[model samples]
Target: MGTFRDAMSYPLLRVGLIMLILALLISIAGFYRVNKTYSASGTLGEGMHYLGDDKFENEYLYHNRTLVLYSSNANLSLLQGAEMTNYTLVDREITLHPEERPVIYVFNGSVNYTYNATAVDYPYAVYSLFAFVLMLVGVVMAFLGYTQFLRDVKEGKK
Candidate 1:
């Protein structure tokens, strides 16, 4: 307790503590966001109905300027002139049926559009993983700093 108190008095230790706290908070928030997005996206996907027509309009919304489209059917195609850029297609095995496995189309686009299909899970998952890693690093660093401070205190007292 004395060592901890002395460590807390140091400016560097204080800054490290603040950083650790912030990292923990960010990681928690990121995880919560990811969980919420997954639940919401699952609900949306379950409720989604297949459009009989090839042409459809949909909207994707997120804090960042990006959109994701998910569909079980591989026969679908995005119409031209949607102004989408850097599009990438990823195969996601969320469904039991191989043929109905979800294909995710990710790209940067405005949230103000209608689409036939859309997904909101992938981006949040990615963000959550990143934050989790950051939190792990911060925790390790804080622990090491605390131990080092304790060692220094013991040496000085000797």
Candidate 2:
């Protein structure tokens, strides 16, 4: 405990604590942004086409009706539990029937596809989780540093 107190008295330790707080705030913001992007849904089709955000590398398409070919730049991969299709990708679009398959599109860059189906964006979810872990570590470090600093101040008065 004494050694920790001595180490926390340094000016660098205070700076580290401040940085940790900032990290926590940033992680929270990131989580909110991910949820917002994923929850927002709109129509994409002949009349109303949906354009993918440049920041996102993947999007999920969900529905239980007709399957239609829409234009997109991303590679479509059927997610697990989704109906398998032998449809070929041609002219940047492929038509599926019965809408029984849930497809997840993977893109090297950003993508813009017709959005006749519900879209779920989660390209940044992993990044958000990573940030959350970092924030947790930062909080623990800051708490220890602050506690030691307080102890040192009390001892100095004695």
Best by lDDT: 2
lDDT of 2 by residue, 47-137 (tens): 2223334233144433323344433333344433445433334446554433333454443323233333334444445666666666677
lDDT tens digits by residue: candidate 1, 1-158: 35457777655556667766776666566444231111113212222233212221222233121223443333223332443223222342222211121333323321111222322433344455665666666666667777777777778851
lDDT of 2: 0.46
- The per-residue C-alpha lDDT of model 1 at residue 93 equals 24
Count of clashes in candidate 1: 5
TM-score of each: 0.37, 0.39
Query: What's model 1's lDDT at 117?
Result: 30
State each model's CA lDDT, in order. 0.40, 0.46
Best by TM-score: 2
Stretches of candidate 1 exceeding 4 Å from the true structure: 1-3, 10-15, 31-123
| Clashing pairs in model 2, backbone N/Cα/C closer than 3 A | 44-115, 44-116
